[model samples]
Target chain A: MSRSRIAFVTGADRGLGLGITKRLLELGWDVFAGSYLADWPELTELSQKEPERLHVIPLDVASDESVQAASRAVEATSGRVDVLINNAGIATHYPRTIHEEQVEEELLQIYNVNAVGPMRMAQSFVPLLRAGAGKRMCFVSSEAGSINRSFRDNWYGYCMSKTALNRGVQCLFDELRPEGFTFRLYHPGWVRSYMSGELNTDGDLNADDAARMAVAYFLRNRYEDQGMQEEDRLVMRDWLGREWPW
Target chain B: MDQIVLITEAHHPWGRALVREFAQKGWRVMACSPVSVEMFQDAFDTDRIHIFTMDMRSRESVQQAVERIQEQTSRVDLLVCGTLSSQGKESAGIANMSADLVLEDYQANALGPIRVIEACLPLMDHGLRRIALLSDVQGSLGLGLSGAGTGYAMSKAALHMAYTMLHGDLGRKGFTFRLFEPGPEPETEVSAEAAAAYFTGSREDEERMVMLDWRGQEVPL
Candidate 1:
């Protein structure tokens, strides 16, 4: 029974998710890393290093059963979750376009993983979140979701799914914000990330550096949302801490 | 040659009104229903209105409806797609919300309209080339206060994003767009008939895409 704060992070096998997991562990918090890639050795290596504090979880955010099982596993080790980070997301194998002869199946799969996955995680973990002192529900979202700031013409599926993700998170905020649950919906700048089974390094920001900023924002105690104004809560902020238009 | 307008979800009052208004305005109306249009036949007595079955949820149904419309007319001047699922509006929160409900809403509210528009695009090459979609103010992040319903409102926001993408890509290619909200607003809401006037009106600037509540006011994306 460790007195350390506990966090459950999705897609924690590598990239930002793994980086967040590592940062949290360094902060002396007990973290359950949800590993989707079974063959990925980084998480297993980290678990070996910090065996007592880092609990590697087998999780598929797209499936309900996997999430439920992950929740059960967390409950057994840590009765409550102080922080729940919804960072499991998938993009199409290639940039999706409406002009593509067929993108329907690919689009729905993106929506299921990027948008609905977070909703499913929140639904399964709210009870545990309520019991924790931190009560932080953090999400790794993207600038692609910002409709007012939409810059691209192609890749409708990934961008729309992110927009949908923002709305779904807003729905959760509307309900749980009143119950004293603070949220941090973030757009981790252009960090090289893993997408469609490949590590894409085209983005300028390093994943590790982006992850450090993400962890700091996730642990931030004071925010504008904590103000008494009713209409001023639940905004999405980017890596540089600029608020995004929903 | 009379102009042609295809409207989906013709079973609803908004659908029926748009059909009648377009027909009365002398444009050929392609009214699509998810079910048999036998029940609403008397409501639309004009021969200018053509009734067909289309389930936007299914790609096959949308293609078949497009084929039927092609057989009846050479081109579609306007496409007014209304894909709204009235189920699960009471889905209180993310916990109370069902994934199936959100997916259903996504199918109807976002993907379905795109299906119909894509299927009908071939027929609009030489016509008005206007695409109108139904949306909700709740979907507008700037206007909506109740960010409560996970499915209905979220799906609408996704649809708004779809509109933005479509307009971004196609608006440059000479396709005009109008996003509409037909809801409970009293002061600024226009009549269902007036919705037809707005849809058929000459606001065909492809420079930007704007959403109007039946009243023709701009909604923030």
Candidate 2:
């Protein structure tokens, strides 16, 4: 209606990213859902229902060119961006051994997607973010990036990459906060996604539940609350409103 | 009197200080470390502390310590763990450290305490069993200055995630898990001066990069 609050969500064809896009649409925001695959059934269905509000773009966050092209297309289509959600990520089965001898190529792939992918997205979209209303960048991170609370081992690539991403986000906070940009690094409690199987087997939330909680968190995020405060980076809350350690 | 069992790593200089601080506040301390029994004799006597020789890397030692505590007390109200085997020197630079060293770092600094938590869970009271794990700001992936200390960094990062998962999984069970990054210890072997010199281009640059709290004061994490 009012030039629509344009939002760009990465990995939006499925899982939590798709859910985030759905919630944003319901809240009357124009969404440019970036998915690696263009022919996802859910994206097709959503696009058909509200073609005016939703635009599905083929985006591979791992590709620098793809991210740049996608950002340009969004800028051209919407003129300005409101929110940038770096939701695209990858995680493989936990590494079996602590040694590099045990780490396979798959681990490296996970690092590229989960860690470097977000960095690529952030680099490409900062301009569009600067052009937006709230000018906020939300990196869907995990508490796994924390060094203080680790209790187990293995999960080498995912742990290292996510940790690097978290540090990157923190550095970004240091750089961007002066410019009035809010970068929120979230630890979405083990959500059942393609990356993290159907059920947590270990008692984590389903995709829908995780998405709902994440959306709630994003909505509740205030613009005035910016920078590297502990509350900003490491707040962990579930659907039931329990605070967990970061 | 609520029974609180404070489990700390003996190798650190701050361990004695923290023990004294908690003891002054009237907590019954159960200090465990790989250090010799004679080393903590004075603190043990003055703080009314019980010192146990425990190797966190060994599950048997951890279980034994837990059993010893269980024999004396029925339930543990709080478990405050400050055990870290890897220091700044060990985790110094990514290029210098071997992958094996890195993994060992994870085991000692991260997984060791997890083993302790698992063993102690059964001994914990049903409600309000607050578990605080001592963490460092350096282990923070979001705030890490460099890729140095690959093993130490990875271990801390993994532990943070593990704690989050544990918090989510155990929230309904009435357990309160807290991951506290006490920032840099000012007067330790890994002093702020040493850390800055190792990680920064210059002392001035390092000084500029320091984080300030809400009060605009440098508060240790």
Docking class of 2: incorrect
- Candidate fnat values, all: 0.52, 0.18
Interface RMSD, all candidates in order, equals 1.4, 8.5
Question: Worst lDDT window (10 residues) for model 2 chain A?
Answer: A95-104
**TM-scores of chain B, in order:** 0.92, 0.78
* Candidate with the greatest DockQ versus the true structure: 1
- Model 2: DockQ against the native? 0.09
State iRMS for model 1.
Answer: 1.4
Against the true structure, candidate 2 has what lDDT?
0.64
Cα lDDT tens digits, model 1, A79-181, are: 8999999998888667755565448898788888898888889999998898888888999899889898887767777888889888887777778888889
Q: What TM-score, to 2 decimals, does candidate 2 have? A: 0.53
For every candidate, how close is chain A to the native chain A in TM-score? Answer: 0.95, 0.87
Model 2 agreement with the true structure over A1-246: per-residue lDDT tens digits: 257678888988777888888888888888889988676698889889988999988899767678779988887887677788888887765554332233335654665677667766777778887888878778887665554454435565576667656655654555566677776567777776766533245538766677777877775664433554443443434455554343
Which residue pairs in candidate 1 have backbone atoms (N, alpha carbon, C) closer than 3 angstroms, thus clashing? Answer: none
